[model samples]
Target: MAMAKLVVTAVLVEGRSKSEVARDYGVSRRWVITMVQRFLAEGEAGLRPRSRRPRSNSRRTAAAVEDEIVELRKRLTEQGLDAGAATIGWHLGQRHGQAPATATIWRVLTRRGFVVPQPHKRPRSSYLRFVAEQPNERWQADITHWALADGTDAEILNIVDDHSRLLVGSVARSTFRAADVVACFHQAAARHGFPAGLLTDNGAVFTGSYRGGGWVALERELVGLGIRLTHSRPYHPQTCGKVERFHQTLKKRLARQPRAATLDELQTQLDTFRAHYNTARPHRALGRGTPQQAFDTRPKAAPTAAPVTVPAHYRVRRDRLDTTGCVTLRHNSRLHHIGLGRRHAGTRVLVLVHDLHIRVLSEDGELLRELTLNPSRDYQPQPKP
Candidate 1:
């Protein structure tokens, strides 16, 4: 527009030739001549540059359709569900009988300020991703923390299939012990069948190798079931990246809802999320199919034959009786308080454990107490005097 005005002013007011104005402005003589004629006929309005876009676009998406797309994005986001362009396109197809391409939907979202460009982030193609060939081939388990309504912290242990992203289990508790981890694993396996292998971090509840080189309850359970167990390298979380990523998604959804007041309430929320994640929510890695769909699409991998002999854990711990005349010993990943009579307070004893069978012997080699551990009870009762 500015160039057009300059050319027209030079030709009409300064009496410059069209060829001179065209050569000076580096414009075509025909364009300069047209501008001068329009200036004489229509005045300043003629010098305004015209739009290069076509007057009409028959193939453009309707205004109403773009509005629908934006509405769908808002609705999905408010519901704590995925509102990506592909997801919006999927929903639009269901409602309108025809949907714009994912790229078109993305452009619409960007134009509406709903999608921000992330040029600094790494490209998806640059990532080296791995997926199991069959469901239950490998399962990733991890624990994440969340705050309750009262600001108390809670832990959620989640197990997911690496192949299908199927959430096998999601258990909420005030704190998860090693025994709790094994129980959750069994619960999930009962429904989804045992996996060929299990992957987890070096958390104390998952492995004892980091602490005095002993077997945690979960490791023992896996070994007994003939399932291989692998731990992420120290300081390397990418080894269990799948479950770690799931924790983020789970927490994001939980953050959108009312904070739970108790462990039970949190467990209820986790259960609801597990159902939706497994059967309803579409996974981007799974080609926008639900985890359940991908899980059922192929045959499942199962654990091989059980080990010839599941190894028994044995250890000896020495301690003095506390003021309560009790000696505490951990057996099968459970702490047991054994009452040994107040008269024996401050007496030193050697606690020997062979699997569940426990023996307490005084320093003088005199047998003080012997009993098989009852896992269901936290306190082991002494025999009557």
Candidate 2:
């Protein structure tokens, strides 16, 4: 094109032969003449052909519609919603009655000065076995945050039965500390009786103790009840797969109701959800049967929960293991030292078992440590004893 312009200038200025200009610039004689005429009519500006764009946009979304789409995309993106402009367009067609293809929509959006957002994909963790052979066998408990009417965030600690996928009990509280959750757990246990086992992530509330266990007081309490406590592997959410999946359903259903004004109000709604979920909603795991169906079929009959009384058979020795993990036990008029799980212990427990395993229990009948009695019991040498 530049060569054509030069040839055209030559044809008009020095009247240099078109054949000579064309040969020098490698252009046709006819091309040189056309360029010369264009230059004469429109001057140097006419040397280049005009763009095909019209003065006005031919295929533009209405200003109002474009503004609406941009605002919607921005809102969704900021809220961590999925998709960019193309997805926004599809979402519009499916949800809001707009059917523009993703590409056409992109042009409209970009022309309107709306930028496409960099999309995010949440990496999926591995799967877990929340499945159970029967209902009431296992339950998982966890807490999630929601806002109150006053815009204050509150914690909702929930319990869901594993086999039937029933929402057994859930409570709303201000804090997620272990004490608060233990309070909720006790509340649930009192109503439903203790489950076989409870599974939870290693959240501070589930694992640590209110007094000093570093493990939750509830866990120790459960262990005392003979209820096993299973902690999900750290950084491994898949271990709590069922509980986490239930959370998704919960957010959708619970978000429908207005935010509660107080913990009581939240509990009321959660109670309603619990009932609805267990009794009314059909669970796929239950072959599209209601969770209540599965729970009721077995007819557990709610046996009287006998207190786990410490049998008088448990020998209580007063002279206990000091901080050095050396405990003095009197058996047949002899003081013997026993090794606790750790070398250093304060008042360590020692259970006398005939077999190799020595079961140790704390004062509260909780299993403190288990040590196997060696065929060879070491008698520490004392100076000139």
Candidate 3:
């Protein structure tokens, strides 16, 4: 527009030739003549630039559909549910015959100020993530703290399937002990079947390795059922990132509700949230399908063997032969003494055991004794003592 006005002024005011003005401004003589003609006809108004946008956009989403998207966002936000583009699209598809693409929904949201741009946030593509291939392949368990009406803190233990992100269990307790963790896991297992593996942090209730290299009740329960128990590195919460993230989402919803005065009230809220999360709310990671839907879409994985009532692995110990020529070991929470003859009394030995097959080795690496342990007997009589 500035160039056009300059050329027209040079031509009309200075009485310059069209060719001269065109040459001075590096514009075509035909363009100079046209601008001059438009200037003469319409004055300064004709010098303003016209829009280059198309007269019509047939591929654009309908205004009614955009209104529906905005309405869905407003409703979901009011309900304390996810209002993301994928979720909006999921709801839109349900209400309308066809739904716009997620990108389109995002654009509408941005234009309407329903979405904020997060330029500094990390992109999902840059993340290295792992998910189980089948439902029940792995379960992630974590505990989060919440406050009650009386200002007392309560704990909510949550269990989520790694593959489907299903909320298998959400229990509200004043405090969670090792026994409570085992009971919660059992309740979830009874409903969804046992998972192939269980993942958790090195919390005292979840594991006892940090205490004295012994198995906690929860760990013992999983191991006895042929389910692999795994713990994230100490202080590294990202190893159990999925459950940690779920805690954030769950708390966001719970924060909007009235504070519960009792454990039962909190448990009721948890049950309501769990039901909606599993069957109604759309999950962004699951391609907008509910967790229950995703879980039901795949075949569930099971433990390698049927869950048993007894332990599967025995602990290995190092001890010196007693003065009475016997080595005692704890098996299945019971102590059993093995006879090693009076000659080897006071000698150090290594007890290597797997199930009932026990091997005793001398400190010098000699195989001192090998026998099948008889758990029924407290003392194994020495042969030919």
**Clash counts for all predictions:** 0, 4, 0
Model 3, residue 309: C-alpha shift (Å) = 8.9
Q: For residues 1-385, could you state the per-residue lDDT of candidate 3 as single tens digits?
A: 9999999999889999999988988989999988988889999888888798999999988888888888988887877777888888888788765688989999999999987778999787887799999999999999999999999999999999999999999999999998999999999999999999999998889976578555578865775577877779899898898999999989888877898999999999999999999998888888878899999999999887434343246564456799988988778998899998899999866576788988886634467888898999988776674
Q: Give each prediction's root-mean-square deviation over alpha carbons.
A: 13.2, 10.9, 9.4
Residue pairs in clash, model 1: none
Q: Whole-model lDDT for model 2 versus the true structure?
A: 0.65
Q: Which stretches of candidate 2 lie over 4 Å from their true place?
A: 1-130, 209-213, 299-385
Quote the lDDT for 274 in model 3: 98
Question: Which candidate would rank higher by TM-score, 2 or 3?
Answer: 3
lDDT tens string, model 1, 1-385? 7888888889878998889889988989999988888888998898887889999999898899899989999988877777899999888877768799999999999999998778998787876788889999999999999999999999999999999999999999889998899889889989999999899998989877668655567765775577777778899888898999999888878878888999999999999999999998878888878999999999999986353223255565456799988988776678889888888899866566787887776644457788888888988888876
Q: Which stretches of candidate 1 lie over 4 Å from their true place?
A: 1-29, 42-50, 305-310, 313-385
lDDT of 2 by residue, 1-385 (tens): 5765667767777788878988888878787877888888988877887687888986666777677678767775554333356556656766677566668668776777775455574544433344766665778888788888999888888787777676777778788776677677777777766777788887777864222233345654664476666667788877777878777777766666776898899888878777877876555557546777887676342212232333334432222457766654444455556655344466533253433445555543455555654444454322241
lDDT comparison, 1 vs 3, better candidate = 3
Candidate 1 local lDDT, residue 122: 73
What TM-score would every model get versus the actual structure? 0.73, 0.49, 0.75
Which model scores highest in lDDT?
3
Q: Is candidate 1 or candidate 3 better by TM-score?
A: 3
Over 4 Å off, model 3:
13-34, 41-50, 54-60, 305-385
